[model samples]
Target: MPVPEPALSVRGVSHAFGRVQALDNVSLSVAPGSFTALLGVNGAGKTTLFSLITRLYDNVSGEIRVFGHDVRRRPGPALAALGVVFQSRALDRDLTVRQNLAYHAALHGLTRAQTWARTEGLVDRVGLTEQIDTPVSALSGGQARRAEIARALLHAPHLLLLDEATVGLDVRSRREVLGTVRELVAEENVGVLWATHLFDEIAPEDDAVVLHRGRVLATGTARDIARGGDLASAFLDMTGLEPAEGRL
Candidate 1:
């Protein structure tokens, strides 16, 4: 049997803005139906890589593929197979959760029935059946984030990419939100590329990539990347931030 193609494949990717290089020869792959964490700090080029992969900015060098379709050369198929939830919320604060999802579904060219069906299915899946009619502005931060994830999945993309998904939520919210996504991978077999600076968001067995200063420094399971010590310790050591990498 031939090896299965990864759900997301990025190779030799690099990007720059004038003299500032945002990414440098970055490469990583996300296995189908698995979760891969892109671990990096604030200036580690995580967002730049996301921007390139999502086509928010064109990738001038290297290649990105979704389910075997090249992102640069075959954007349609490549993009059709991917879903994204950026660090910033995309739901309209004024619109009800139902309205926000319906509007976005329309943008994906989903018909009324299709939109309704997916929304109904996902509302319960995201634990927002009651909040479906609630305005986004009225919902809690975690609820809103879940709504955004629902919108991203409205198109039924094969792969999901979330950038710092739990950024501002409280501990319980973050756990619930992250747990929801992990369930999707197990039950629905959706592949996930989750980018975050919080090492706690990842598990010991998860496949991970460490990106620093626009470069990939390591790739392996979380425990492997952590080596003999803890993840935070290993990360600081790998990025040459030793001694002290954080300040209050």
Candidate 2:
């Protein structure tokens, strides 16, 4: 059988900041409906890669394509096909959950009727139905994070890019958000590029790319990289870092 085209593609992409080369010929692809994790340490150029893909920054070299459309040549369509959930909260703390979603919907060119329908579905999906009318500042941290996810989905994007999305959440909230992401991929057929450092965030069967020093060190199923041990240890080994000398 012929291979299916990737939903998102990055080829020979590289970027720089002054004397520091952030990305050095980095390349990867996200298959349709697949949940691919981008694993890296702090300042490993993960955020730089995200910025390039989202067109937040223009790279001087290489190609970025979304669903076969080149991001550099056709930015509008490429961006329209993507939904981004940044690490930081982007919602207005003073706005009601519903209102914040409405603003996002408007930006995505959704009509009033479509916005309301999408908002209701997302609010329910993210388990925020009860707090839909409450101001964002009144919600807990987890609730705010869920709201951000809901807002990102306002356009029904084909690809979702999450950057450290579960960083500060408690265990319960983290699982809740991750569960929502899994359901989205399974049900909506949306591809995901989840950038995170936590091993728990990657399911055993998921495909992942280990990035270190602005390069892809390994890419395969989590089990393949783990090689019978846990992913955290495998990751440490690949990055040339030794595990701490203490038992868990």
Candidate 3:
């Protein structure tokens, strides 16, 4: 049998902004139902990579594909197979959770009934049942984040890209959000690319791709990349940094 195509494929992708090279020949792949962490420090090109994958910028040097559809040549279907939650908060503050999800569902061309059904389903799935009727501004940070996650899943995309999804939440909230996403991967078979700089966010079981200064430095299971040592130690060795607190 032929090998199956990856859920997401980035090949030789490079990007530049004037004199600054934001990304340099970056490449990675994500498999279906798997959780892959894109680990990098601030200004290490994590957001740049996400921007390229989402086509927020113009043409780049390499190719990107979602579920076998080239992002440039067949953008519509390719995009339809992908979902994203950026580091920024994107919820409409004035809208209720249901309202926000419904708006996004409509954007994907869901009919009234389909929209309502999916809204309810995702709200329950993301554990926002109690806050479904609350406006985004009234919800807590974690609640709003959950709502956004629900909105991203509203389209039922095959792959989900979360850029620093747990940036500001407390430890409990972070754990909840991370656990919820992992559950989705196992139960819904949704592929995930979770981008974060925090080493604690990556579990040992997760597949990891370490991005350092716009290039991929390592790729393997988290433990393998850590080389049987703690992730922090491995990180320092790979990046050639001296021991220090509060660094990547």
Candidate 4:
């Protein structure tokens, strides 16, 4: 049987900023309904790759395709098929939760009725139904983060990109968001690319790609990459860095 084409395909993608090379010939693919994690340390080009995928910054070489559509040549359609939750919260603090979601839906060209239905569904899914009308500034950090995730889903994108999404989140909040993401992958058949340094955020069955010094050092299932070692130690070994004291 022929292998199905990946929902997201990055081919020979490389990026640089003047004298500094942020990514060197990085390439990977996300299969349909797959949950893939990109693990790397600070300045490992993870953010650069994400920026190129989302077209936040244009790369000088290589190709990025979302669901077989090239991102640079067909940005609008490619972007429409993607849902992004950036490292920085992109919500309007002054807006009510519902209002923020409505704006996002509008940006995606959803009708008012469609927007309302999708907003209600996402709010319930993310467990923010009770705070639907509350101002973002009035919500707690976790609540705001949930709201942000819900907002990202307003357009029902096929590919979901989350960048350092669990940062500053308590365990309960982290679990809540991650669980919702997993559910989205299973139920909605969305491809998920979760970028973070923390291995605990990933499931054993999740696919992992390790980036070090602007290059992809390894790609495989999380358990396979770890191979009886803890993820932190495996990462350190692959990147040629010393493990922190007390870490297995």
- Choose the strongest candidate by lDDT: 1
Q: Please provide, for model 1 over 98-192, each residue's C-alpha lDDT reduced to its tens digit, 9 standing for 90 to 100.
A: 99999988877889999988999999999999999999999999999999999999999889999999999999999999999999899999999
**Model 3 — which ten-residue stretch has the worst lDDT?**
239-248
lDDT of 3 by residue, 67-116 (tens): 99988888888878888999999999999999999888888888998888
RMSD of each: 1.4, 2.0, 1.3, 1.8
TM-score, structure 2 vs. true: 0.95
Query: What is the full ranking by TM-score, best candidate first?
Result: 1, 3, 4, 2
Residue lDDT tens for model 2, 1-248: 98877889999999999889899999899999999999887678889999999899997799999998898999989989999998788899999999999999888889999998899999999999999999999998889989999998889998999998988899999999999998999999999999987787888799899888788989999999999998988888778765542111
Note the residue pairs that clash in candidate 1: none
Please list the residue runs of candidate 1 whose C-alpha ends up more than 4 Å from where it truly belongs after superposition. 242-248
- List residue ranges in candidate 2 displaced over 4 A: 244-248
Error of 1 at 8 (Å): 0.5
Model 4 lDDT tens row, 67-159:
888999999989999999988788999999999999999899999999988998899999999999999999987888889889888998889
Q: After superposition, how far is residue 111 of candidate 1 from its true place, in Å?
A: 1.8
Answer with 3 or 4, whichever has the higher TM-score: 3
Residue pairs in candidate 2 whose N, alpha carbon or C atoms collide under 3 angstroms: none
Overall local distance difference test of candidate 2: 0.90
Q: In lDDT terms, how accurate is model 3?
A: 0.89
Cα error, candidate 1, residue 244 (Å): 6.1
**Alpha carbon lDDT at 205, candidate 1:** 92
Candidate 4 Cα errors over 4 Å, as ranges: 245-248
- Score every model by TM-score: 0.97, 0.95, 0.96, 0.95
